[model samples]
Target chain A: ANDDCSKMLLNRCSGCIAVRKSLNSRNISKLLHSCPHRCDHHKIIVEAEDKYKSEVRKSFICNKKILLTPRRRQLRIES
Target chain B: MFRGQRGWFCGSVGQDLRQLWVAEGGTVCDVQAADFLFSCDASHPDTLRIYQSLDYIEDNATVFHAYYLYAVANAEMKTSVALGHFILPPASVQKEIRRKVGGFIWEQDKYFQIEKHDEL
Candidate 1:
C-alpha cells in the first residue's frame, strides 16, 4: 500500500509537470479554470504564470525592433 | 538510481540541482556527455527547439525540467518529456529533499498561500 501510494504520488507529480508544460504559453486563467487535472495545485500554476509574465516583459524590453525604432528615427532625421 | 549517472545542469537553478545531484552520487559532465540534462528554462527558444527536435536529443539521455522539480518541492506535481520530462525520486525521498530544500527556486515562506477554491 505504501508503494502504491508512492507510485500514485510520482504519477501525480509527472502529470502536474506535463500539465504545466502544456499550459506554458496559454492563458493562466485557463489553467486555473479549464485545466483537466482539476488538482489542487494552484501554487504551481501561479509560479508558471509569474514566470511567463516576467519572460514576456524581458523579451519586450529586449526586442530589437522596439529598441532600434528611436535610433532609426534619429538616423532618418540626421539624413 | 542516479548513482554514477552523468548529469548536466543548465540555467541558473541548475547549479543548485547540480549540487544536489552530486550529493546524490551523480557525476557532473558536459551536455553532450550527460545521461541527464537538467534544464531550468525549457521555455527558451534554443532549449525549446532542441527539445522539439527529436534528433537533437540523445536516445539514452533524459531531460529533466527544473520547474518539475520545483513543483515537486512545492508538493505541486511531477515528470520527463519534450517539455515535462522529470526524473522520478521515491516519494519518501522527495519529501525528505523538499524538507531539506524548503522551496526549490524561491526562498521558503515567500510565496503567499491562496485560499483553496474549486472555481478559479
Candidate 2:
C-alpha cells in the first residue's frame, strides 16, 4: 500500500477496464485523479481517442441496404 | 467469443454447427450467419472484399441520393470484419468499395446485397 506501489498498479491497467471489468475507480482516482503523472495524461488522451473513433465508426454503420442490381454497360461512341 | 442467449430456435450449443449473429457482438469471431460474413484468420491475410451492384451505394449528386444514403446507413450492423474487407476505408486498401463489392459480374451472380432484417 505504498505510494509507489499504488502508482505501479494503476500504470498496468487500462482506462477501459473501469467500465468493462466494473472496477471501482476510487482508489485509482486518489492515486491518479488530477495528480501530476504521465499516466493521468495518457488515460485522458486514450479515452478521448476512443470516443472520436466510435463517432466515425457510427458514420459508416450499415443501416441502409446497398443492393446493386447490375445493368449492362453501353459502349460510348464519339464523333 | 461468448454469445448471449437467443431464444430456443436459431441453433443449439455444443458440437452442432451453430450460426452466429454478426451484428450483436463487436467482433466477428463469434457471430452466426457465417454465409453473410467472412474474415481472414491470422493465416490468409490477403483476402479481398466487395460491394455488389445489388449492394452498391449510389452517388450523391443524384436526386435519389437522399434515399440511397438512407439505405446504406440503414443496412444491418454486421461485425467490422464483414465490412473491413468490403466497405473499408481506402488507406487500408486503395480501391473504392462500390466498384468491387460484387466483382465484375454483369448480372448473373447473386452478388453482394445488404438488407435490413425487417425486410426479411
Candidate 3:
C-alpha cells in the first residue's frame, strides 16, 4: 500500500498488479476508471526530454519518422 | 564501472531506454561514442550496420526489447520479436527498469503491462 514508486525498483505494487490484470479484462473507458496509473504510464512512455521539447511541433513527429527511415548513400564527385 | 558507462538507445524504445539507463546511474549518451547499445529489435539491418559503423561488436550491443503502443496512448501499432540475438537485461536491474518504464495497456481486459523483453 506504499504509494512511493519513486524509490521502489519494480512496479510490483498492488496498483501496478491491478493495472496489468485490467489490460486483458476491460475497455478503455472502464479501464480509465479502474486505474489512474494508466495515465501515469502514458506519461512515462511518451514523455520527451527537455532538450528536444522545444523542437517538437505538430510536424516534428513526421520529421522523426523520416529520420528513422533507412538511408542509402552514394559516392559523389565534384570535379 | 556503472557510474559513467555511456550507452546508446535505438529503435522504438529510444527515449524510454535512455531514461531508464540514466535513472540507473549509467550515462545515456549519443550513439557516436557509446559503450553499450539498447535496441528495440533487430528487424532493421540498419541498426546492426550502425553498430558496425561505430566499430562496436555484437557483444557490445543488445537488442532484446520490444514495445507496443496502443490506441489509448495514441500509438497505432504493436510490435513483435525480430530475428537477432535477444538478451534480457541483467536480472538485478530488471525490477528497477520495469517499475519506471511503464508499458502498453490492453483495452480488452484493461490491464497495464510493463513492456519488457518477453522472448528469448
lDDT of 2 by residue, A2-59 (tens): 4433343345334312322111111222222333434432344333323433443344
lDDT of 3 by residue, B4-120 (tens): 656555554545445555654667666545544555544445454443331222122332332322112322322121111122233223334346753222212232345453243
- CA lDDT of A74 in candidate 3? 26
Selected candidate, larger lDDT, 1 vs 3: 1
- Which portions of model 2 show Cα errors greater than 4 Å? A1-42, A61-79, B1-120
Residue-level lDDT tens digits of model 1 in B1-120: 246666566553444555556665768766555555666454544344434332221122334554443443344332232133243222333344445432232222232222222221
Per-candidate fnat, comma-separated: 0.05, 0.00, 0.03
Per-residue CA lDDT of model 1 for A2-70, tens digit only, reads 453344345443334444323321122333344466433333433343344345445546664234233
Better of 1 and 3 by TM-score: 1
Poorest 10 consecutive residues by lDDT, candidate 2 chain B = B59-68
Native-to-model Cα distance after best TM-score fit, residue A79 in candidate 2, in Å: 64
**Whole-model lDDT values for every prediction:** 0.40, 0.24, 0.35
Interface RMSD of every candidate?
A: 15.0, 22.1, 16.0
Candidates ranked, most accurate by lDDT first: 1, 3, 2
Q: Rank the candidates by TM-score, best first.
A: 1, 3, 2
The candidate, 1 or 2, that scores higher on TM-score is: 1
User: For model 2, what is the C-alpha lDDT against the true structure?
Assistant: 0.24
